[model samples]
Target: MADTIISNHGSSEKGANPLPANSVIVVLGASGDLAKKKTFPALFGLYRYDLLPKNVKIVGYARSKIEEDDYKKRISAYIKVLDDKVKKQLEEFLSFNTYVSGQYDKDESFQVLTKHIEELEAGATEPHRLFYMALPPNVFTVVAQHLKRNSYPKNGGARIIIEKPFGHDLASSRELQTSLEPIWAEDEIFRIDHYLGKEMVKNILILRFGNEFLGASWNKNHISSVQITFKEPFGTEGRGGYFDQFGIIRDVMQNHLLQVLTMIAMERPVSFSAEDIRDEKVRVLRAMPIIDPKNVIIGQYDKSDDGTKPSYLDDETVPKDSRCATFAAIVTYIKNDRWDGVPFVLKAGKALDGAKVEVRVQFKDVTSGIFKDIPRNELVIRIQPSEAVYLKMNTKLPGLTTKTSVTELDLTYKNRFKDLHIPEAYESLILDAINGDHSNFVRDDELDASWKIFTPLLHYLDENTDIIPAKYPYGSRGPAFLDDFLASYGYVREQNGLYNWPHTSANGKL
Candidate 1:
């Protein structure tokens, strides 16, 4: 892929085309925390790696009129600079940045932005433009329309990157896609769901299709259940106002975990191209039926027993009688020939025991008369905190006794890729945007298919305000009924021993 595209240093390779010399990346909502923490830091990472074209300009657009020095300070605060050389690179990256204050809906503001970009690209050839919308959903379409109408490059190409929470439900999601698809071509719009860029998430395909052993047991005949979990230890500290509008389901389970589930359950694509991969994903999602509320469990966090952490209601920004769920566990089934009757459980929560995200694929138990009640095999792919791929299997005890133990064949990236720098999810996505690689980005039909599976449950949860959620103390794993919920779906839990991979047995870390 690197050889296919020219680097920002203006390389003259056989098949690589030099990046537009006059490219400009404009960061909308530049005064917000997303821009400062994620968008700008990602841009800086690209610049430091020499992946961004030389002489390309970066513009910051927002409604706030902060001082240029202050704006620069906020955005660079999150960039990690190891030494003086990287420090100087950060200084140089900041040099190309300039700020402009503008309203999202007004055309005059976009015109001003266009004029500034034109002035910056006065003498350079192929003045390409990229607009990054770091703003709230309410302003997404308005800003996109204005950018297309007023600031769209005439002689060069233009691309726009938009973030997730595309909409609250299926109807709204379709509306969002309908409104924007007309203004921007499908190829030019980059719908970003940052989870797709995670290192382990990207490796799922290689882990499944590249390895015959794992791929062989990836169907209903060999697998019992699949669980995708996202847990966060801390609640929304001060962003309750935004978080309350869309609870844990919309925040994590609906998009992020569901995306992971699709990757796990989809059939192998014909090719590794963007459309082929996404086509397979859409097929799997279309086979999945709308989630049943009966198979769903919603919970709200109460104050911890230690009383150190705050509950959902304790947040001043949240409504006192809010029925919003802070945690959710949903069961969905794909009625395809490959995964028929197998349960796929997606769970997400805030203020849980710890922060972790992983997919646990539990294989069916051994059908034998030799050993009494043995635990089933499980393949675990840890997506974050500590990236690893471990397969839990039964092994004989060292002694000459007819005993068995559960151990894992592990692949921790930290031990294996010791010299490799694992790029942040944002860094990977931004680089893909620069290279025009749409493989990691979301497509319109993908969004529609995903929403179709969750919209009915969302509507039920919204209408039934009188129904109270299960209360779990902050920092605990989850509600008491969580185990029962899993059991209902024929999910078995190991009751014998503490299972710790990579750190347990000697030579297991490999």
Candidate 2:
């Protein structure tokens, strides 16, 4: 407990206790998509980088009857063997891991898992347990109850890391929490919103609070409208059953993008501790009411103009009459001293021109004394694909007679830090869970506040069948109304060719 389990990349989990010398990371739905693609691969990354505790044991649990070799193959499929060293590490990591077939709600099944865990911890002096709930929401509480009852460490502390789709809405989210609170204390639960684990997303705090120039101007006086966007270039190719159940609002905007919004709009925390960071986020959310319908625009993508990509309806798994919005843009306000009138636009879509998550803070234009029609200053935090942070500002064109253009002060991660390994979002979050750091995790109250912000509008979408989402061409930016929606909230797009990341990063000139 004296030493902390440090992350491979720099992490803000400084105040947390080290992983207990004897601990087990149990994946409850190890055979599912989340476990194979995210959970196992993340654990492998921790193992590869030697960030995990030396004596820790990994246990995989699920109802599926998979042979040991097959399970290992499935789990390790997504883990890339970059070299012979990684190949050797993957072999040793597989040796360190084991699996169990069990029912989520059945005590008998969990007892078998507990027996397997105990066998692994036989000689351990103080064994701790970390249960990762990668299962769906319907079985969250049942598995939590069973794990608490059956597999919880006898003398050491235990924690659970639950994945998203916390619930469909506020009432349902609370219902899910009600079952969980009785079995596990708040501190023992790590509700993961993986967006918080992204490199740029985590940097938002330091970018704002760690620097004086940025911190001084981070308020309504200097800033105009803030936009948080999550755009994916490809549609959900034929996998619409689960996606149709939760539209774009629940899928991306409410949880991931809203979490990003809080980091941008929140006041500086009293301390860097998890409780303090999460507390500030809750206060920011509490200052706002449910988003007004008039401030929301929803859209579903049509087929690409060409004869290639399929529309949302073209997916056989999706209902023919499904009207779930594939894209949504909403403008909401936080009624606090720092961000009173500044609009925060949260836009998300499945099929678009490009794939990236970013936050753009548009500043008020400079007084039009000499530079009339000059673009406003904007600070952009790119969250994925290639992480970067840049500020678009007015600059004098070289060798010109008082001509101005928009150029950027860029910090593209790849260009600046060559060959640096920015850990995947899941890897960062999983490491936080192991280190017992909740700074990036969602608390019960925080989740509730987020749900409260979007539930009313979600209900309206579900109840009103007559409301049809506007159509937009697949692979395009979004619906035509998207521009008008943003404009209504006082957002002005920067001039084309003013800035591009590749141009900025390649050379200093843009």
Question: Which model scores highest in lDDT?
Answer: 2
Question: Once all C-alphas are superposed, what RMSD does model 2 give against the true structure?
Answer: 3.6
lDDT tens digits by residue: candidate 1, 115-167: 99889887555578888999899989999999999998877888899998899
Clash list (residue pairs), candidate 1: none
* Model 2 alpha-carbon drift over 4 Å, by segment: 1-15, 496-510
CA lDDT of each prediction against the hidden true structure: 0.87, 0.88
Residue pairs with backbone atoms closer than 3 Å in model 2 (clashes): none
Listed in order, each prediction's TM-score against the native is 0.94, 0.95
Off by over 4 Å in 1: 1-19, 505-510
Model 2 error, position 136 (Å): 0.8
Q: Find the 10 residues in a row with the least total lDDT in model 1.
A: 9-18
Give lDDT tens digits, candidate 2, residues 332-428: 9999899999999999999899998899999997887877777888999999878999998877767536766667799998877765689999999
**Steric clash count of candidate 2:** 0
